[model samples]
Target: MNATGSVSGAERVLLRLADEAIKMGDDVVLVSPSGPILQHIHPEVRHRECKPIGLNGLRSPVSILKYGASLLRAAIVLLPLMRSSNVLVINNTLASPLAFLFQKRLLWLLHDVLGNDLRGAIGKTASRFFRLVIPVSYAAANPLPTGTAVRVVLNGTPLRESKENFAREGTTSVIGCLAALTPWKGQKTLIKAVAELAGVDFRLEFAGSAFPGDEEYARELRVMAKESPVGEKIHFLGNVDPYMTLQSWDLMVLPSVAPEAMPLSLLEALSMGVPCIATNIGGSLEILRDINGDLVPPSQPHALAERIRELLNDEHRRMVLGEAGRDLVSTKYSLEERTKELYWVVAASTDMAGKVPPRR
Candidate 1:
């Protein structure tokens, strides 16, 4: 169950898992906020929309009251489903408390590092009630209670065949940053770095929309980009299909200042043989293990720009990195392998007995 309605990395991962479960002859039901985003899910999977909830991230008293009300409402809606299902897999920690009602039947999937104080406290309290806590990465698991029943399940992506080497007729190298346009995502840092390389023949493509309360921040990014020396070179592509468009880019950049759990974008890019330049923080360092890509210090435009320039000038190095990235993803982070691991955990947690099917 995902708390938010938006089609972000967590939502995509949940959908992929549900699809994999369906393929294995398991009945899959998705309970999320009702929206057009639901259209992306497989038709075989059952879809249910939870009642619209107010912003739970807000620290205001009204927000807290609304969050409580939303949880109560969610519990009421889910109680009936909980009775019929052998296990409940919750995708977000905000909904973890609902597991308290189901106890052993519930599995909480942690997709991010518990950064918020209040949320972390609540997640810690809720962890004791859950049968298991499956964090998507080691970074995600580090903040959880030491003694909790935790398993680190690294997220995966479909392995794309390496593309044929193509000569770029265009002069400018395309650098794509495929993430939400938020402050901590470091889009501003990237823009600053591009501004530093005023005469460089490279275009920066920002390909994501803002979060709910981050519209102003998106506007700020636009203003920042506009004020940059190479303002026209910065293009905000809003939201594009990364799988379809990522292959067109020469390089992928993830400049997040905050700790990412395990960014699906990074995985997807690597799977498509796209070399990455990311900030050396959170799961990124873990993702870029063994020099799969370049790692720059977070919030440093000069460092980021230097790496970007270094990559842009060296075609052979970029090709080698891209091939290595694809190899790394195919070997260590395939969707089928990770899904099998997830299925095993689910099977072990429940009383499936002989009904638990073998991995396909």
Candidate 2:
């Protein structure tokens, strides 16, 4: 997107991707509106903040004019940045009714399950214009017209700097959720489930801020947490560092009601040797299992509460799961390895068209 106010999974991936590109001796430039995400980008990368309008449908004449004006502004802002780069990576179609303008060099990093919704329909149409369509997981690649080129590259997390025993050793067990506070993330369900465990020595913590427009939902969550029977146990610890956050929690839960692409939060937890319990939806099933972790039915407080109780009570199981989780991540999800694969995929595509800048 040309502008973003908060960082989510997509932004995390972009940061890593930019870091890798710069390490490989390419000049990297981040073009977006001034936002919180800029703070995380690599220092070597150039930042070109722009004021392009967000994604919207033009149902009226005034809207169409505004959209046209924004597109013109975006084109103007991007012109200087485009000369030194050949490949353009876009996570969403947010700044565009203009995808075709950069058709030959554009790569669509698909992060949604394109299943007939308006966004999906737009994705289906936009797929035709991109040089390569890179979806984060198989779950995110779909419903496009015939012969659309596609590739699925899973997101990755960095391995811990030290294989420190990052496990929680507190007498009071801590259960945490590490995602932005959005209604669809199902934080309320987690709170309700945590409340069911009366007399259990545990604390439920949420470690993220709301995405820009979702502040109201965050407030609602705080209210619900305060009203919960285990009100004292439910804590809102907003935007803590993921590495430090996961280390303090015995168990992590992702209770998403909506489909996910590939969640980096779970990746970070697994990398830190923390066992995760996520609801079965979207990419959760792809990430967690009974072997390394557990998955419960989405939005079910009883099932959620029961599983939480079992894991909190069984220290041996949590340990085994944690070891297995760390092993799995070390083998399959290292950003170092994924960076090579990403370059291979992007390079392979660019080789066919001779479009990407040479990696010096």
Candidate 3:
């Protein structure tokens, strides 16, 4: 289950997993409040809309009451069907509590480190109800209850052969940042770093929309870019298809101030043979551990600027890192490998013999 049908990183991972499951001849049903966004991607996966009654995660008394009602309603809807299934995989913490009614068949996939106290408490409480709690990264798994049955399954992406050889000798380098326009995403830091590189012949593109109520933050980033000395070189492409556009860039930058949990964009960049420079926090470290990319201190514009310049100046290093990143993704983060692991987890959790379908 997922909160929405929006094409965020988590949602993308769900769609990919569902696609792989269907390919393995398993019947897959995707439940969400929002309309099914995966229909175009995986036409065979069943879609069910259990419309949430009200906004989730609000702290107000009324919001809390509404959230509880929504959970109860969702539980009523899901409990009957889940009890008969061999295994049910929940994508996030919002719907984790519903698993209590049918905890025997439930597995919770913890996608984040729970940045808020209340949510963390709720997640910890819910962890007891799940048969297995799978985190996308070791960093995400560190905060869970000490004795809870836990597994770390790094998110995966489809590996694509890169077209570019990363040999930008004279042409202007294009650096792209693709993530939601939130404060912790650190787009402002990236803009500042770009401003510091005013003398360099490069262009910066910001390709993501702001979350609800964060439009002002997005506007603030655009204003900051406009006011910078290199304003003319910065472009706010607002939300473009990273898969189709990332290959055109010389490098990708993810300067997040907060701990990111296995960003799919980083994987996509690496799969496309694009060298990435990310902030040293959360899953970025895990993603870049064996790769040849660079990791700078989070929220440090000067360090980010220096690193960007260093990579831009060395074309050979960029090519080497890009190649290494592609190889890493192919070997470690491929969809087939992750799907196989997930299938085994389900089979093991359910105590089923050879229930894992043969790979296509």
Candidate 4:
């Protein structure tokens, strides 16, 4: 997995895949640009830190050249790791070419959409370079879609809650922003919506952390929260255990202002039987179907606030929508079924070699 490989959604997906693969008696090798996130890896999984490749530490032209050298270094180092693996699960599109080099079976599990803003994450120049190169690399990599483009794995959720009935009380409802505390994610927009509904009996919870080098943005979000009218009503629970966190909320909001490939948080919220109110953009719309919840236009705090009000006032509607969300996830995003389908896709296209198929 070449993702940032932290405790984020992508990491969660990778960890689950690695853990299950281990139980099924498959030897898993996790490769990252930096050293392995040893703390997060499954005990059975092997870790290798490939040289930092692609756009890391490459802002200036000189650094870009250095990073290119690093890419070559990574490719050289990863060759052996690639040769030993039968199935290669790639998280980011940028690293697809590296996996392609060794003829490794590719399961391009995408968590974010690739586009201008995503490219801009590294910087304008890096973004432009990626836009130029990634598409061709992705095309050549030839990855098969895994049943659903997005999968949500719900861990640490109480199975008993699945059978229990919870009371639907007041406008004192919860709107959860299940994303990293970054500007691009639009947690500020969710806070603004909460501010708009200040006098209304509703609360918003900001649940997630900033990425490795984004502490500054996280601080800004803290400031924004304090200034908002519903500041006290909005709680910043920085990166809680997702399954447990979703249990306490009635609603989930992604509100990503940037383009996204897929937002797994939507899937997590759905699986936990919580209704969502996401922006009408990217993978948000793809997951938050009309039957499950509302999808308002991006950056419009008013629209978000109004929708929250509607859902808060109507308990029956919320229950119906939440139940529908759970059902949709159960049928479409079940990990076992999706992973099995993905296994076939990898097995069919790549050389499985001496590895035996895991028992169903």
Candidate 5:
């Protein structure tokens, strides 16, 4: 798999696939712009730092130049990886659209829904280009691609086995906000919601880091907390270790102001059998609906708080939803199952001259 170096929702998915591939006794090599954040891979898995491509561009003209230059460097390195392997998998099409253009039978794992407006930091022209070009290019290949050309890989949680000793119950009513402390993540809105839940006894744990040089947002959160009635209830467990953070929470709250393609945090929470309260925007609603928990309208702090309050008030409801979530995850979001399917997707494409093959 060829992944960009930076840690984001997409990269974590690739890491999970690497772990699963190694566990199943397959030869897996994780190629990235750099090393990974979670370094828990088996010795059989190879880690290589491919020549950095698109490492230093932010949707400017310089970005186009850097992107092209980086890919050129990556091409020199990727050929051997592709030659040595039977199938090619990529996180997204940005780096290796050529792989698709050249009919390499690539499996592009899609994290977000693509429209004109949702191209990360890229500008309108580039976004339009990608939206227009990617589908057409993939369709031109041998095994005529389908929606399955882009596999939607969801995050999987580790199930804790039932034990004989009575389990000491941890805090069941936790408001877990796992997004970064950016304005779009709606940290302030969540804090306001907690403040509104003044008399309610609940704990709010913020689990993520601030963007580069955005300590001011952290200060703002502190100030907002101090102003709120439940200010003392909010704790910032800044930049949590993924495993530790998942272990510590009973439920997760995702209140993104901006539309997300898919939130790895929410999926991770669901995997751990933790119910989630998220806004009905982007893929959050699509993924969270009818399985685990409530979906409130975006920017409605009172409504968000109320949904959380309902879960808190009814332990039976919480357990039922959480259990349903676990079952849904087991059936739909198992990492091993997804990767195996992904490999087959790539293998099918490879053998069929990049055409998307019909299901048997």
Candidate 6:
């Protein structure tokens, strides 16, 4: 795990997976390049901390070599750790760089939809060791080679305990985008969209922390929000409780420019009967389309803004959409079922099936 402070959907899923594994009587050791993530580790799980590969370094010619050495050091530290493992579950292609040291005993729980660029090429190349590649969504699987070992395992969100009331009276309807503040997550696009909503009586909340080394972009977002005409209505709520957070909003938005494997925020929001509008891309498209939820074109703040206005005005439609989403969540995305399926897959795929029993 290339772990960090900002607990986005991926981090939440990782922690949840670990908790589930341990609950099922498996000994789970979370090994990672140390960061604020270590602070949030469960007491039940053994966290083996290692030095971070300085991928967060300043741009320089020698920086590459320095980081390369750092990566090597981290890999070496983790090699012995992996050798003892029965089934090594790696989230995304994060551990791919370390694959050369111990290639065989790895199960890639793939999450990224890398493009046809150099990074993507490298990610694909590393798939030579992916004895089992389980993508959280079909969109994530689409980018990989046709014959590559790919299994589509859509992320399952636990149902919200509290019922939502979309008809709550409010002079200022709150529009929120709950995701890690990053370039690809499209917080910028959301800000731009909200900026255009000057006539709309709405409060926009950007509820997430920036990535470890990406504070500059977070600063940029604050500046952008400050400069907008409705700047006072826009608030930056850093790392609030996602489940509790979704309950307060009249509408939720995920305006990601790039493809996510599957964002848990969307799932959580929808599960709670909150009306959501996400960009028509990757897993978001598949999810929203299935529930007949609203979606706008990626990077088109104008379209997003328009959709936001339309949804906020139509209370009945918003209620219906919310209900539909919640229904889908209840019927299909049960967390216990998904976790069991994951264990079954892991057990069935590897020779260490006996070691990785479906339950402890």
Best by lDDT: 1
Tens digits of per-residue lDDT for model 3, 238-317: 77878777868899999999887788889999998889999888899889878746999998999999999999999999
**Model 4: how far is 93 from its true place, Å?**
3.0
* Every candidate's lDDT: 0.82, 0.77, 0.80, 0.62, 0.62, 0.77
Once all C-alphas are superposed, what RMSD does model 3 give against the true structure?
2.7
Of the two candidates 5 and 6, the one with more favorable lDDT, higher being better, is: 6
Which of the two candidates, 1 or 2, achieves a greater lDDT against the reference? Answer: 1
Off by over 4 Å in 3: 36-38, 52-57, 165-170, 351-360
TM-scores across all candidates? 0.94, 0.88, 0.90, 0.79, 0.74, 0.92
lDDT tens digits, residue span 1-360, model 2? 434634788877777777877877777788777888777888998888777464444567897677667767877876665565767777755553346676666777776666566556666877888777888876676555677788888888887732246444658988999998988799989988988898899888899988765788999999999998899998988878888777788889999987787788988888877888997767777778635469998889999999999999898898888888777778878787776667667767763344364564
Whole-model alpha-carbon lDDT for candidate 6: 0.77
Candidate 5 lDDT, tens digit per residue, 149-190? 333334444544311122435644567888877777888889
The TM-score obtained by model 4 is 0.79
Which should have the higher TM-score, number 4 or number 6? 6
Q: What overall lDDT, based on C-alpha atoms, would model 5 receive against the true structure?
A: 0.62
Q: Report the poorest 10 consecutive residues by lDDT, candidate 3.
A: 49-58
C-alpha RMSD in Å of predicted model 5 compared with the true structure: 5.9
Candidate 2: where is the Cα deviation over 4 Å?
A: 52-72, 79-84, 93-97, 142-145, 161-169, 290-292, 351-360
Clashing pairs in 5: 142-355, 143-354, 143-355, 143-356, 144-355, 144-356
* Candidate 6: regions farther than 4 A off: 2-6, 54-60, 162-169, 355-360
Give the per-residue Cα lDDT of candidate 5 at 167: 42
Model 3 residue 311 distance off true place after TM-score fit, in angstroms: 1.1
Ranking by TM-score: 1, 6, 3, 2, 4, 5
After superposition on all C-alphas, the RMSD of every candidate to the true structure, in Å, is 1.9, 3.4, 2.7, 5.8, 5.9, 2.5
